[model samples]
Target: MTRTGSGHPRHSRPGDGQDSRRRRPPPKGRSPRRRRRPPVARTATANGLPSGPRGHWFLVAAGLLVVAAALTLDGYATGVVGETRPGPPAGFASAESAEVRRGGPVVNVTGDRPTSVRLPGRTVALTFNDGPDPEWTPQVLDVLARHGAKATFFVVGSKVARHPDLARRIVAEGHELGNHTYSHADLTAVPGWRLRLESSLTQRALAGATGLHTTLARPPHSPAPPAVTDLQWAAMKELAAEGHLVVLTDLDAEDWSRPGTAEIVASSLPAGGEGAVVTMRDSGGDRRQTVEALDLVLERLKGEDYRAVTVTEAIGMPSAHRRAGAVDRFFGAALNLAQRASETFTGVLRWALFIAGALTLGRFGFFIVLAGVHAHRTRGGTRRRNAVGGWPSPPPVTVIVPAYNEAAGIQATLRSLVATSYRGELEILVVDDGSTDGTANLAAAPGFPGVRVIRRPNGGKPAALNTGIAQASHELLIMVDGDTVFERATIGRLVRRFADPAIGAVSGNTKVGNRRGAIGRWQHIEYVIGFNLDRRAFELLDCMATVPGAVGAFRRSALVALGGVSGDTLAEDTDLTMALCRAGWRVVYEENAVAWTEAPASLGELWRQRYRWCYGTLQAMWKHRRAVVERNPFGRRCLGYLTLFHVLLPLLAPVVDLMAIYAIAVDDPLPVVAAWAGFVLVQGLIGWYALLLDGERASALWILPLQQFVYRQLMYLVVIQSLATALLGVRLRWHGIRREGTFNEFTQAAGRSLPAGGPRRP
Candidate 1:
């Protein structure tokens, strides 16, 4: 063997060997020499993410924990079902018995405790319970003022805290306030100590609102004097010990029942000139009837010579107690803060759920419409076809295969490329990007002819591709990943797409070559469904986002015009394609141009790969965000599509997932499951159609549903991690994947059928 002018080995006769060796070397300054860089030693984590991704994981966990805590607090406060903690009392605890003693308005309960409510004859004390409502409370106050009457309002502490202004207004307008217990929970249903806290909390709320405290209290759920039960008597004794006057209604208006105004007047008038207390609500529901009844009852009471007065005033007691201490003020402030926080968080969650539902439905509708159009166009061939694979004399092409430490798969990839059936002048540039492995040596080995190996420093993938682009000897360039294997007609089919001069780049259909495991099959389904279908739609819209690196065809001038592969993003292919589109060039998808590439076989590998891809895509998007406002077609269509589908949709996807969980646990799980299943079904149908169009089996879609459970979550997490890291301004280094050369293993492990030429490795 003798070395030719191009440094390739050539066969020579024994007599011609000396002459071949003596052939003139390349002219001075014209010879291409391999570029070398010193190897730098670096440490790597277990997951292959440079600088470690653990910090980003921590940030994401912290964020999720915050959201979870907020939701948990909101649930706890609302007496929501399914929560582990005990909820508020179902209703006011059973009523108790109390009697007026020694001709005094004070009531002596059966529990050997003194509770007082002075019931003066004829001068009926008309009191309303459950008040401080924003809307109805104001109307009740106005009626009281119009009649020149004042009544005590038994205000629920929670409502007073929520509407402190109304509570203040009630006092400013001369109507007195009474405690109805914080949250309106039944004291009898809770322990004695809890009952004390409930009363104290209400006193604190009153103090915070009106700068005054009231000892007058009304036990919830007791309509009249005789209705108070034993348990309620015990609770009443407890409140009495705390200096609270338990005011029980004598005449029950039952206005909370929304009974007619006439009945309310009749009930309040009372039969035999006995002073009484009436019960009504100002909040917690529509209170139109309560307000109306109060107006008519007040009018009838005036005609009967009965004047409504505050409970304390009618009972002949102090209207309000002395100013509260520091502890009471602190409790009031804290309760108000918690209530405000709970309300805010609840409102946010409600809106989040609504937005999530809308986005889920919108995504469904958008994809269905776009996919339907894509399928119809595919069936009808509305776009002009660029005939591929039958040219008598195809144009010359150069295939650039960028390799790092891809020694394990490079040989088979090279073999697959050499076997392409295109009858064109084809050259292969194997740019080994500073690999420690024997990739460059193997590519330049005598077994591989016309394969030139160019060595460069480990400047990353984009740099390596640029190196290859600079050294290529042909006008048409096809980029192939070192781990990818192409079909015999793939190159021919790809180059044919460029028959239209406006076509700057063409993306090929890249299928997972190593579909031996569950993970691989899931990716295979995704490639078939998520990616290919979108590409078909994008191609028709002339808004193609990416020309995948696995197997893509490009014109040399177009690539150079965009400054070759961009290093600003890890997704250089996407960046370059978008740049080309923005530069007034067309990017198209060619489904017939098929390449089989090894996908990540493990969850960890898949996460790292997808994280880099998503993060880099985000970087590219931000770098070109200005395109959104541009007037060009690429700006209007491509930028708009990417902004909606890529950026906006991914950001909104997590909300859908969260809503699904919340709905399943807190709302209705079956409908969420049904909706998810419906989405999967539609996606599966789209996948089936895509496979049929690509001449692949639709059976691959069988794993799609399973993907939602495992693979889809992993992808969502990847997107989340990337977004978290990017938002935090954390710079991530390129992480190399630990490839097992699954291409060879897949062929043997599954006993799968090979392409026409059979397995190239073994």
Candidate 2:
């Protein structure tokens, strides 16, 4: 079973690497008609949850919708379904004295129902509805104060809660207080508990603001007493039971309709020398007419020998104001806080939606720009690295494969390395980072004869790589993850780029190996479209952000100059690469060198893995923040680029995702879908181009839209969680993904054609 130095058997064909562009046929005996496995379809919960928090967004939206519906129901019930009290026009009412003298059953509260009070002299009570409004309440109050008149304001509880100072001013100005019910809800239409809350909460707010509780109340939209329906009467009686004085007006001044002042004044005079309770609105829409007509009405009333007074005073009944006790004050404070909290939540949600949309759009625009720039840079083909002279005749290289619970893929990774086609001295060093599995034994097994295994305590990947660097016999080092399987020419291609003396590091192209499932396909698209193209751009600028752990080559002297891999951040590769650039070493990309690595099998695993990567990248960026102030090209472009694209863009990406959720939940879905489709279309074009550049297939683009719905959100969450954790000073331990040796497909396919492979290293 002796195999070639390329790790493939002697009979192996060309294009045997895990290059998706090259499709290999079945071996001599095997059937060429093998059925491809279908993508795995994972089931969702009863609610059809794809991912955990994504489903929770729907729940949140549903809850908000419920709250909004309740508020709408209350508003509609008050405005349309409930009662509207009809008042007599001026010069028409003559029952003022008769009704007062014809009162039935002992009434509890004065002004509870319109009082037909026959005062000692000709007197009229002026009452305003729906007020404490900032614009008009003051004008009405000023007019009343100027004319030496006092009015009763039945204020909406919500309005009072918002403008408590206005409520206080009303009491301070010698005006009477009355409840218009919270949010002006119709008590006759709502349930019993809601009715109670509507009444009581207003009382609490008024008491809290003015230290006086008003027993005077007017059911919203209720008509004059004689005209109230039996149902409205029943509701009024219920309020009476609660000790609320239901104020009904005798004269109707429909100034709320913006009628002329003369008409409003005409509507206010009492008929047949009877004292009437006059009604006008101070708030609830444009009230300029109300404010304007007040002085004219006052003058007319004075001329008619009618002294305008508070409802209680005109009715000769005691004031409804009760000084609030400590308990009442406390209740008022709690009620105010509750209302403010609701308002605050609504405000915050609106701001969040705006911010999310802005960030989402910004990020999309930035990605487009970056992709365009990347395409222009690598338009014809990959530009060569700045290494002094390309390493045409390569030097000896030591490959370090760091493993942590990677027993599943370590052998394949090592075999892939041993089979490299580089004609230089090469050795394999497997650093098992305290894997409880048989990673060490497997590496030292008889099958992998020349492979060297070094065991150490569970120090992280950075520590293990550092150990490998210290122990390596060669000056040229290649670092590979235990789960990554390299192609035969991957090492040679990567090493050749280091020929430029200034080129300190080269990042290799990474491909997703297990593209058998939907998740894998999504990641496959991302690797080809996102990461590889990003490297091409980074390489053009001589500021490669990360020399991926999957496959990268570096000069040992450059590594030592930067003190090897630093454990200060979780993303050692990125940290090291940035450090190299900051230290005046150029880090470039090598697209020809390809390595196949397993993508996470499930969402949970994908989240955990990406969480670590995103978090580490942020930490690394922060550690190198000082680079932003440097004057070099590395600082100007590399640090500036990282700060803008990597740091700022990621932060904004989550907001965009949130805006997407908001749009889907609240706005029209068509525009949202259209915008998203447009973004995806652009993304697909870039991905397809990148795949073509990297010599891979575009078939994986089919899952690009699905990725937007599922994978894109998961990635955004990862970025958000990572940023939050980093900002909050929370440290996350390394989380390893469950690997199932995805490279076995490539190995199985290769083995079918090739003869036995004797492990060969240059």
Candidate 3:
């Protein structure tokens, strides 16, 4: 081996041997080299651990829990059914005496002895149930006010909370208010604790809405006292123990069944003008009939010289409403505020779902149309080139592999490069960035005679690549990662693109080599469906964003003019490609030039790798944000697409997911499920088409549905964390993936059969 003036080893050729007897001193300005420290063995736990504090995940979980609780409360409050269903007629208990069973509708059991009372002759009490409706309650109140009649409204607490103004208007208009339970749940069907809870929440709602609590309670679906069942009596007794005066009805108009207005009005008139309490509804359904019946009933009663009064007035009892305490008012107000906030949040999520769906579908269509056009153009170009006998004479090329502790795969990488079918003079440069695993020794072994190994301190991949570019003897260079393997024609296919002087870089198609596991299959699907398909589309638009490092060819002049591979961004490939595009050089994609790279096998490793990729891409996009306003294709096409589809759409995806859950909770799930199914079907079609274009089997797509449940969420979370990190101005270190040397076996086998100088050019 010979040394240049800079003390760096020159490119070694076949049969170049060092003199065993010569002992050379250290270079002029530098001391003898210190032994490199063995690289630390990173454990699986280390790979899985997050680089930042885990507190963010805790906060996210807590926030999700709070939202879930709020949605649950809202759903429970508004989704109750059967609130006005008629009770069974034959379930009355026989324990009650004839006097108690046949007495008045207002029953007081709060004292040692139970008491029942009826209205006096010619005095009627009108009571409305399931009320405070925004629509019909006001109409009912208007009719009563017109006739100077005072009635009672048994208000559902949820309805009152939602329409507090209506509750207040009832009191202002000289009517009485009574509790109908928080969610209009049936007292006989609920447990003792739930009954208590129902009463408590209703009181709080009343306090929040009207600043008062009612002692008059009406169990939902309660019938006249004569028909009270054993279970109903037990629940009424519990309410009495809680100091409530149970109010039952004397006459049920049954307007909830939408019976004719004539029947409703006839039912409201007491038998022979006897005093009675009549039940009607202002809510739970269309109540126009009830409103009209009330007007007619009032006119008829007035014709007979009968007067209408409130329940408490007709029963000779004091007011049922009292001012609420301060604590109840505060908590009730908080509940109202929380419910409103949850409703607002749900609305936002619905809008987000619509926007995300539009963007996603639009992107899918864009990829399909443009990618098809690109494929047609590429095939036509290939046909024309074949007619012209391809490149008359290929140019000399240098292949640079930057390695760091890559002894596990360096030999395989070198062997794969040596076996290339490229006709031109080919040089392989392995720049070992201070690896303690004998990476340089593996590259310079006896099996690979002409491969050159350059040793340098561990200054990172960008520095190592810069050193390789500086030392290369050819004007065309191809960069490859130490863990990637190439097809025999990969270099030839890549170099052929340089026939056009305007082409600055060519990105080869990258495939996953070890895609047997679930994680690997998911990545394989992404590479084909996401990265490569988008690349095809981008190439046609002339604004390709990234030329992957695993296999990419570049004109050395173009690279040198831009100051080779800057370390300013972790995604150096994307940064460089963007710069080239902005500099007016065309960066294209070559689908036929394929390279196989190993993908992460474990979820932890995959998370780390993708987190770095996403965060770095964000950094690069920010660093080159000025391009958006520039008059170049990179700005007009590339940046716009990346921002809309990649950043904005992904950020909105979680809302779409939340909306699905909300629909199932408070709305119909069939529509949401149908939409999801349609989305999946469209995605499957796209994946199938992509596999056909890439010459892969469609069997791998069976995992696509499962990906939605786990892989998709993981990616969304990555985007969120990346955005957070970017917003916080946090600096992230480069994450290194541990390689398993997946291609070693095949490359070793090929190496044994090939000649010492590698295979002959085809």
Question: What are the lDDT figures for the candidates, one per model?
Answer: 0.70, 0.70, 0.79
lDDT of 2 by residue, 393-460 (tens): 56888999888777787777877777766778888899877777788888887656457999976656
**Per-prediction TM-score to the true structure, in the order listed:** 0.82, 0.72, 0.85
The stretch of ten residues in a row with the least summed lDDT in candidate 2 is 1-10
Q: What's the CA error at residue 453 for candidate 1, in Å?
A: 2.7
Which sections of candidate 3 miss by over 4 Å? Answer: 1-52, 80-90, 94-101, 387-392, 447-450, 499-502, 636-679, 751-762
C-alpha lDDT (0 to 100) for residue 756 of candidate 2 = 23
Which 10 successive residues of model 3 have the least lDDT summed? 1-10
lDDT of 2 at 708: 75
Clashes per model (N, Cα, C within 3 A)? 4, 22, 0
Candidate number with the higher TM-score (1 or 3): 3
Ranking by lDDT: 3, 1, 2
Candidate 3 local lDDT, 702-724, one digit each (tens): 99988988899988888777776
Model 3 residue 422 CA deviation (Å) reads 2.0
**In lDDT terms, which candidate is top?**
3
Off by over 4 Å in 2: 1-122, 251-274, 341-349, 383-398, 418-428, 433-459, 471-476, 487-502, 518-545, 586-593, 614-622, 625-735, 751-762
lDDT for model 2 comes to 0.70
